[model samples]
Target: MTNIGGAFRRNINRIGADNLSLILALVILVFLITVVSGWAGYDGGDKFFSWQNLMNSVAQAIVIVGLLAIGETVVIVAGGLDISVGSVASIGSVVAASVLVGVGTFGSTLLPTGNVVVAVLAGIIAGMVAGAINGFIVTVLRVNPIIATLGTLAAFAGIAFLLAPDGKPIGVVTQPDFTWLARHRLFTDVGIPDLNGSAWTGIPVLTVIFVIVTIIIHILMAYTDFGRAIYAIGGNEVAARLAGISLTRIRIGMYMISGGVAGLAGVLLTARTTSGNPINGVGLELQAITAVFLGGAATTGGKGTIIGTFLAVILVGVLNNGMNLLGFNTFVQRVALGLLLIGAVAISQWRQVREEKVRARALALQS
Candidate 1:
């Protein structure tokens, strides 16, 4: 019994007590919203609660900021930041689309393995190359992450614009399977009844992709040495460097990861919209920042989680969908979102302070 009790305690320790309250708060909020909305005759079926609407919401949330959050989580945890994620996303899609169109009607038998593979690879390569440039500019020029990424943000955006010379979408990308990835339902084969007399059944394919990608990323960040290094670097760059960690390589890796993921998001967005424009991801950086911050990553660095990000993403989705359903104007919605973000941050800071105080008191008593 003692052994079993100790084992249970150890498991509890691994989970950490800090985030339990956040989870509780999330549950309470969700419950309160559901009950209140139901009482008020909300019928969020068309608003945010429907499978289609929820999937659409999740897709929009993930595709625009998902990659950026994954990348920023690494970058910020590594004690750096990049403002060029949006640009990378824009460039990535443009490159992929350009490659697809350039492949012509013999798309399936192209120089590469297949058109799908080529398109994905094109985006990945464009993003990685752009990331490398950002890293070089940061490490070589010794520029601040903000400034360096800002300059590259403009330059990369320009290059993406150039690649999209016609300023119009290209390719026969409307193929059902390809289009279904971002715009179609997941269980049409399962035969779910459709509301609104519309044929949009079950879950959106984008939501499934987001879930799969998020799970993979969650594992990667939690179970790898590279992931640990990212957190250490962000927590204390000087200490991390003094500990014999490779500051240059890790720094570069963070940016590259950021760029690569942003590129991935671009592809998903393009698939959803059937467009591959240079200006596609405009203001996306802001949304990504919002997601990162909302996900519980400290603006000052050294704290984050995949779960936190998931909750935050869903929170934003809920807020957006709810407000739209409530018929709130754009200005009001923005104001509410801003206030919500600020409040969450303030709560985090307050909790951090309280925990520090508790630790200090315990130490003092022990002494």
Candidate 2:
């Protein structure tokens, strides 16, 4: 019994108290939503729990923001923040659409398939360039990350509108191959039927992409020297410098990764909407930032996990879906998200203070 108790304690410690709390919170929220849904008679007398909703609707809806959150996690872990990702994604959307349509200098030179390839590459490169610019401003120009990204946010949004035809959305509905990323599903025939008797559409490609990206990021952060360096830099810049970590290189790389992921999200946005709207991805940066902090990431940096952020993404998605199902308006949803962000930040600060007090007590005892 003693050995079993010791093992359980060790496992709990390994998982972290905050993460366990987050899990509990998630479970409670689901239960409450389910109960409310039952009482309100939403979804035609069915409760909120359903395979279709989880596998299809919620998963698909969260992909874009989820991708952004993954990138934000890396940046935050490196003691940096990026507020320009939404604008960067918009730029990517317009750039990809323009290339696909052979607008301007693209000149209809490539075949349809070639255009698709080029457009995807162009969008991703545009995002990387934007990220590189942010990094340069922060590292070489010595500007603060927040201020630098905020400047680029407005600038990039302008650039996105300019890149579009007459500052309007460009239609790509004619491109069947390009829209596959948004419309197609894997194993369309395999999933369980919904209450409406319609067979599930299988897993969304966008969701699959999000999952793959998350897994890769988790691996990178959990099992690599580069990831350790990022944490060290965030934890203590002076100590990291003494240990020979290249803060500039790591910071820039992180920004680039963030931008690249945003670009991919933009590509999917274009596919999902069947157009390249210059206004696409507006306000998404806030949600991504919210998920990062809500996932138990330290506001002062040096502590976070991809898994935590992913779960937070699911929580946010479910909350939004439930509100929509309950006929709540966008304004109310926004208010709820704002409150959640405040609560998450407050908890983080409280934890930090408590840890400090515990450390002080330990030092005194040692003395």
Candidate 3:
């Protein structure tokens, strides 16, 4: 019995204090934030994590942080870093919104669903194409990732401005296919003789779509050879190249992934907000990157988990929700977040350093 208990303790400790600490910190903060969330009148009525409010918070987190973290994860795992996620997300949304409007003016009853599907697909593809362009400049042209993305970041935003210079929002009239995304799906038992209760609980279809995309990404990263290659290259691009890995292809792939994921986020945002702003995601990049770092992505690259990033998103969502509940000042909120990010990165790095030391010492002693 003692041996078993001791063994379990040893295994737990091996998981380390750093990760454990973050998990605990997040949990404790959740409760505290929940309490504060009530005060924000977040529901426009109550001091509680009402199902609706909680769902809203989750949706928002998935939209904003999801975009940033997804890109950050891809870049970090490819021996690169991207700080232009926000602009990319905004640009994608604007383009999607524009496309939706263009299709809606068709005035055909059958056009709505087809148009939305097409617009979403095109948006995702466009995002990937944009990311690929960034890769071309960074990898093929040998420009710095940060510098390259930053340039595109500005250019993309400028393009968005040009796409809607007058700041007019596109709607069904722009194409005849607008209402379906807002209200098209029907939920009922298959022509049942007498369906009990309204056969459908009304909810946003986009939620299911977003969750599905995240799941697909998680699987791709966790179970594919290409995924492992991503980590290997990110961990050491020179070593990867020497081992016959295609650094160019890997870098390009990561950027493409970043753009594609951002496109999904863009769809969600347009759906939720019912329109796209020319400057909707100005600081989202920083916040998403912070979330990735906070959730324990290695600054040196090649070390990150989708699950960790996802959890980090939830933690951040709770923090924001809690702040509103607590009636905290908006300005002070971001300041506090900044400090937290710096502190979390410092602690995570320290933990990594300690682990390396311990590992080295163990190996040396064995030798």
User: How many residue pairs clash per model?
Assistant: 3, 0, 14
Q: State candidate 3's TM-score.
A: 0.81
Task: Tell me the lDDT of model 1 at 104.
Answer: 26
lDDT of 2 at 185: 85
**Cα RMSDs of all predictions?**
4.2, 2.4, 5.7
Q: What are the per-residue Cα lDDT tens digits for candidate 1 across 137-241?
A: 898789999899889889888887767755555543654454555766656677666644544566666667667777777787789877777787777888888
Ordered list by lDDT, greatest first: 2, 1, 3
Best-fitting candidate, scored by lDDT = 2
Compared with the true structure, all predictions reach lDDT values of: 0.71, 0.85, 0.68
Global lDDT for candidate 3? 0.68
Candidate 2: Cα lDDT at 97: 86
Alpha carbon deviation, residue 367, candidate 1 (Å)? 5.0
Error of 3 at 350 (Å): 1.3
| lDDT comparison, 2 vs 3, better candidate | 2
Query: Which stretch of 10 consecutive residues in model 3 shows the poorest summed lDDT?
Result: 103-112
- Flag regions of model 2 displaced more than 4 Å: 37-47, 104-114, 191-198
Residues 1-367, candidate 3, lDDT per residue (tens digit)? 9999999889877654445666787778865665444575444224433544554544444555765686678687666877666667766666677666652222122224336776677567767877888889889999998899888889877765665536554443333354344333334233533222223333445555655666777788879977888899877788888999888898888888988887666655666566755576667776787778777777777777776776676677677776766667889789877987897678668867987899999999999
| Model 1 global lDDT (CA atoms, 0 to 1) | 0.71
Of 1 and 3, the candidate ranking higher by lDDT: 1
Residue clash pairs of candidate 1: 77-234, 78-234, 79-234
